[model samples]
Target: MSKIQPLNPERIAQMAAGEVIDSLGAALRELLENALDAQATRIQVEIWPSRWQVRVADNGQGIPASELEQVARRHTTSKLDGCSLGFRGEALHSLARLGSLTIQTRHADDAHGWLATYDRQGELAHQQPAATALGTVVTVADLFADWPLRRCSLPQTRPLLTLVQNAALAHPWVSWQVRQEGQLLLSLWPGQSLQDLLLQVLPQVDLSDLRYQRIQEGDSDWEVVLGLPDRLHRPRPDWIRVAVNGRFVQMPEWQRLIQSVFQHTLPRHRYPLVVVHLRLPPEQVDWNRHPAKSELYLQDPEIRQEQLRQHLHALLQSGSEQASRRSLHLIRASEAKSVYRVTSSPKSPDPAPSGQPSTPLPPLKALAQLYRTYILAEHPQGLWLVEQHLAHERVRYEYIQRHWQPVELQMPVMLEGLSSQAVEQLEQLGLEPEPFGPNTYLMRRLPLALWSEDPEEVQGSLRELSRCADLEAAQVAVACRGALRNGIPLTLEQMQQLLEAWQRTANPHTCPHGRPVYLALAEKDLARYFRRRWGICDRPISDPKLGSWWELEPLGDRFAAQVRRSSSASAPDPKDETRSAPL
Candidate 1:
């Protein structure tokens, strides 16, 4: 017998079915594509999880009654020209092999509809006249019943719902609904604009900062809608959706291109929510790259990529500059508010009477500013060097934490261009913006930190804060932006005030951004570096007796003598004066 032989018909059928209709999601996708290709205006999907069955009905030009028997036959289709989503002609045939397949349809030319059933071999087994509207209904029962393993591995309802939603997004003009066991899972009406459809699908995303653009080239038209870089970002790139020629497909090169445009704008390991649709002439794209028709090859990919990159860069660049200006205006407003605030003068510390306990951090006297960045101070236990910027950040962060109360505004501010979901999120974060009009809110109060901010800037900041992953991250961003910058001169009184404020913070060791606020050099470490005989040096270095312990012989003279001795000797010692303990 030959080692390799042709497979039997039953085994071949099993393998082919496994490839095309592998999961419930795959089967649903095929049905949806068929409905869309038929120019469906309304589609409904019903599922029975207990029986692993699905039914898809569509209002479109359906199959002809006379050709109903040939619908499920292998290698039979009307979309051989590659313009339609399903050109392989194997979807119905493979589905029939996996389970019981029944299709009921009525063509415009036919007087009535016909229902046909197919067996596991994909051959028509029964045909009968049926009363139905001018459309098609495909039902698959007991899917993968013959293959128990595959049946158990089928996907759950979520993937099926996702498939339907993707189809709806790609064809927003069509109405769609999905139900499971008589319970509605999703419903989308027709005549929804693209922006409205996106907002409906992605309720969690804040579309207040959304940007849209359309471009037309020689034979291709592109529509790009996306969220600008803000506090909103996802840990994964799954939010990026792309559709080509009315078909939702995976184009990784384009996804990466979009990411590259926002690489510098967004933080590391974060991605923006972007939706792109490209409509090109059929001849410019090859849709036969993948078996399921999820991937495609586009002509002149490099040129298209460059064009998209330029467009995104231009838009985002202008957006970033505007954001910066808003931030600057807010900061200046805050500074103005601080100037008029009443603050008590710093009082000198009184000596502890009868030896009472002191605070957690010992009172330090500010000596000088080192390099105009770090503050040098004298502490009881050691010499302290504090990063000016980090210390100020911690101070501001804690102040905001303790004083983050909402104050009633004298005049109610009208915040426009906010989504309903955005308003809800703002309320959850303690803004309590009431709905005033369509995509507008009436804000009667504002957070204490944002009180002095302009109404427009406050609106922008609130939108950013609402979209952030959490409260702490938003606080960090605000504190970081408003903190004192490094390399700026500070007076002795200003330095002292900053140090006093920092000392009162609950977490003074590290800044809100997790950077070390100060470095402490203890007396013992300093003594050890000077090669002192005893661990502690209580006397001053100017004292003649303590001079030997404070000063060390020049290292260059010792190194030179060692090198001369080594040259005169037969061999140098492995370890010499060159190796010394770290200072």
Candidate 2:
């Protein structure tokens, strides 16, 4: 290669754009941000044939007639108010360099609008009078054509739709609409409240069921509303929004913080619908750190604490009618103790085919207990050995999973010295203890599948539930606790019941935690290990001490013992090749 030479201005300009625009989605985001920054209240977006063409029109402040073409200049902006969504100047500069750009705008004072079009070099190609309202429309066509490599990474329709949805949710007060190939795809109106707008977005949830709350601290405020569990079948994550001063962003940390609130209420793979808006002074929020202006950092401790407080409150409300202060007082997630309220079927799954005998494994005949822990059972084909504790656990877990339902206590038990909120939170775990006397409550019901469990086992189950993150774990934990305790001798009736229940369960081989419940040893396999199954020796090694080569025969223990005693006192007969054979 020749010595490195300086690149020309044209090459340098294109190189600078490579860092600014990477995909069609990136270009679209820039266009959308610019529209919002212009104070657009009604925005319409149109896309054609995937990433082929895109146009965004906003009814907001428009550029002056004289300075329409100058907008392509680098680092140029009219947003000096500091309250604008973003001030990064690379968006338009990079976009114009990637493909053809057209801007049609008219100021309110202007009699008519002017249209300016440009090629990838940021040079104006056409300028003429164009009919338009008091707003701006920016259209980018031939996306990433100049940079063929970046164009290859173009995303499908889903990603672009997600970007548009985020923009719409960011400005709930703004009327938003979308069109694809002259066909209408989405329409949203600026309604009375955010919930109204969300209702239009997600018709699956009933708007009235969502809980709403507003909290303020100093100059900052947070508005949040969420749907009830019954109505929480949310759509794509694009529907869940977190905006900072009317600007939606990609903040994983904020999303995770919100997810923590609904940990016990929803599965890990699923999420509930929530709409939250954080309004604060522009100076208090920092958006300059990320290239997308998508990440925001909150520097105000008061606002941070308020977020934690409200998050806890919402979690409690959704979790149970009773909110426990003990769990909510801890603001930091590191210190927050995990507590779960059980939400499940109100009754057991169903009685095991009423009065039908459970399928029995007759091969396993119960024999005796070993170490007071394992049950030894005999079988002609094999030996059956089981750990009663684990077996019982598997039996109960499977039974409960099938026959799960709410449970009623045979008699009430009383306990004292717990607060009402505490009791309520506990009841969420399916323990129905109610107030009976001062600082006391009478426990009346338990989780349906585990109602007949020992009180200690029930308490243990609840304690285990506190460590679990979801409902399945809670159910498994309860089952494990209610099962037979290890080292406890079981009566004949109890063991029989356990076996019968285990047989009724769908999965009886392993406990809920995935540990094997029992082991089987085949008699033939055992005989092989004992060296007693060889009918006759095809070959034998000579033993000088006994002066004999061995042969096997179907002889009892007494004959083998006599042969061994005689071999110790006698030498092999030299002339007899059959001397080693046992009769």
Candidate 3:
């Protein structure tokens, strides 16, 4: 048998390219991450589509002339001591194998920088002097030039271009640019807030009702901003972004939690848009779970997912409740009868009408509140009995339930003395709070009334809410009670207005507390009750029907003929399931 010599560097490089990095974009992302980890203040990326060249220049710390060879070698990194999430061994090797890799660097202490180029032999092809700077610049040319199979498998330019745009949107705080044939296709400015970036990129998006959120779980914290009802757009499933420890991840559970909250509230096709920032202790998460670093593994993932969901639900509930309360207040204030004094305007009224004294009249009739609940009013349409408490509660509940953008609070509110049981339970309910004080906590902002106003009340409510395993139901209950108990009286005009408002609300039949508001007696049902129509007229009644006196007749005997005919007409088939079940 002939002895086999080791494969040549060209063969090794080709094999490495195919085996290591999955795609050109993923390979580029790895390099970018390294630059970011190096504390680069600004990074500039240039792409030459015609020449198949990609270059990334960063003002980060550079490799010295002496260390140039080692830096270009495979499986080498200065940033990791094996404790970091993305300290993998194959990034540099894979890039070097697939393309012509060149690196130019300047050390802070030296005036001159070193430049090195690596060829297919796994050795430095050339090393020379370079320009003066205290940073590193890497350029890759002829990507996948040696590997026809890998190059052929790569996606076309359009999807690749979209990828670049998405990356820029994900990191608005970092300045970035993507150029094709030396022409800029994507450019992002630094210091831009996420919302600003969203508005700038998604011009059609309405962000007027955006709000902020934060949730703390021991050392872990979550922050986010969500869009309001009018701001929310349909069909875009990925309107939400979740980041752990300032690094973004594409966690499926995050979407599920928020989607579950809005599933019943939003229409069948509508999706809630949100941007969430999660910060957990570095040790608690493994960010290298995927090549893109968009997927992560939390040590206690179930707890984390639940925490995120509850926090979002809380923010949503709070915001809706607050809006409902405000609207109710406005309606109450508007209902207060205003008294006008007759002065110079009275001179005009005196000529218009004859009065014993020129006195302005009060309301035509005083509206009565029956049983401290119903409002009896005479409208132009007809007499209306408005269930005051239930109507107001329904109005408040729907307004609170309306979708809105998320708002972040300047200060985090942390609740204290929470039983360990409650804390554990809260996580299951998705209420993760960040530490703010000795024992108090700051919550990720949710809609105002979705969460309890008092922290002490929240602990119990959360526990109960979780027990039923139905948070939305619990939220409705709480909101309804608060709304109905306000005891805001309504005038006749306001009562009429309440009907208009209720018509605009969702599920107007039930109060926020899950109680019925009104019962409309239809003409048919009312007539049936009086044995006038659609009634069981066969029953013997002393009252006469249609001016005819009721004759004495055996009720059962008279109904026998009708019952026999009905039974015969609707007789069940012998082969039916009910008949076939048993003898």
Candidate 4:
């Protein structure tokens, strides 16, 4: 066997450090993530032009002075022994190659500290005694100094501040401070909650329509804070943020869930602003699977998406009801359509003729329920599904949710003793159930479908709408309860009528949530399944006796018995063309 050759520590360090600075921000984020994993409650990051320095000092137990040199070197870490959760030597070794890096630490058990530094070439530049407090301080500067193009591309002080600011908001428990050219840009105290942190950074936020929620499913936990439907910052919901295990990432599947919830509420081209954080077990999610880690590998992305959609839809229905009551004077286009001219024409006879009255079915042809999601009715040759409650409430609430219109439909409705902020958020989301006389609003009008239903339940549904967000998130709050009452029976006539109306309605295939209303099985597919010729006769031969036939004898030359079978034994013809004269 050939002798083994050892890797030069200097060469390995330089190469790794180069790679780290190449993906500078991402690499820094990884280190910061490690700090968080370490249970650090406070983190401070600083920048020096092309030179970048990050200091993460935590109250957690510090490393002993004796091991400080080893920790600063390549492939050394204290976090790895407990759980196989983070990097081994990759993070530190990378940092060392890009610049002059150093680590200083002191422990409560040890009175002294040690300092070690690595130069740009990955060689150990120095090791010395140092004075330090009872914690760890890691500093790295001159990032990418050896690579001009990469160094030039590094963000200036201000942009870096923004990056740090965003990260700070994500972890509310960590007090954060930022400085550029000695000018303090962001200095924030510990936040009581995510909302509290948001208020601190985005002071101008219109919380009047905000909603927040926390949902747990098995090993996954999600926190969602959303704005009301109409109050979305853009025509469509654009402001959406997804965080997995506290690391902000772009998750397209998650976006689908939010879009499904906002389908009809906002106008085209507009998007909603949402911030959602998901805490999933690290093993279940493969962060290392990708170079950027922005994209995630979810074991059940579809299921997770559906869950999010359901949660949002429920909120929309509840919010609409409350808003409709408050703005009783408003009128929506849908409410106007409710006053349709009852056609008197006898029209076509019942198509099915199964004693089901030839009801006035809409141009729609089919209705499909996806895991019992928003009902989807066919959109002409296509499919359309309506959010039973959102569509109903939109029409009802739009009329009632007006600011200056007269109470033409919904009367002021009673609301439970909701908090003041919740009431404001409701109105912002277009819920304005007016106060009838203290705590109650005059129950006047409702979504046309809800007219015959219980006003008490409608009110209660709106009250319990967004269980996730503050009751202030009007649309989200009311959407859940406002949805089709689970298991409520509908008459065939009612079902038919609702289906018809939905088929002609805009966005027939989706309710307010972007969930599909129905999936169409094309005509060609039906023919293929039946193995029938396309638009041609070659009809199956039914009666051999009726058609001309020649008799054949057996091999023995004996005369064969001519047994004529009836054509009736063949498959039945779809078309009763027998009534037509023989061609």
User: Using TM-score as the measure, which candidate wins?
Assistant: 1
What digit string (tens of lDDT, one per residue) describes model 1 on residues 1-583? 7598889977876777788888887888999999999989999999997888999999999999888878898879988776788887789999999889999999999998999999887889999999999999999999888779876654688878878877777778999889999999889887444556676777765445667677887787877778777645679998788888888888888898988778867756789878878888888888778777789888999988887777677656545324433344444444453212222421112223422223356666688998999999877776778899989987777666666788998987887788767777777778788878788888888778866556676766676766655667666666766688998999987888888777766666667766657766665555544436544534324447655432554444456567779888857564531221111
lDDT of each: 0.76, 0.68, 0.59, 0.55
Compute the lDDT for candidate 4. 0.55
Candidate numbers, best lDDT first, in rank order: 1, 2, 3, 4
Greater-lDDT candidate between 1 and 4? 1
lDDT string for model 4 (308-359, tens) is 7776766666553344311222223222323232233312111132322122
TM-score of each: 0.55, 0.51, 0.51, 0.50
lDDT of 3 by residue, 227-255 (tens): 66433546877676666654556778777
Candidate 2 local lDDT, 350-393, one digit each (tens): 22454232333443446678887888766466666678987887
Per-structure clash totals for the candidates: 0, 11, 45, 64
Q: Pick the winner on lDDT between candidates 2 and 4.
A: 2
Candidate 3: where is the Cα deviation over 4 Å?
A: 1-16, 81-85, 153-172, 192-203, 287-294, 318-583
Best model per lDDT: 1
- Which scores greater on TM-score, model 1 or model 2? 1
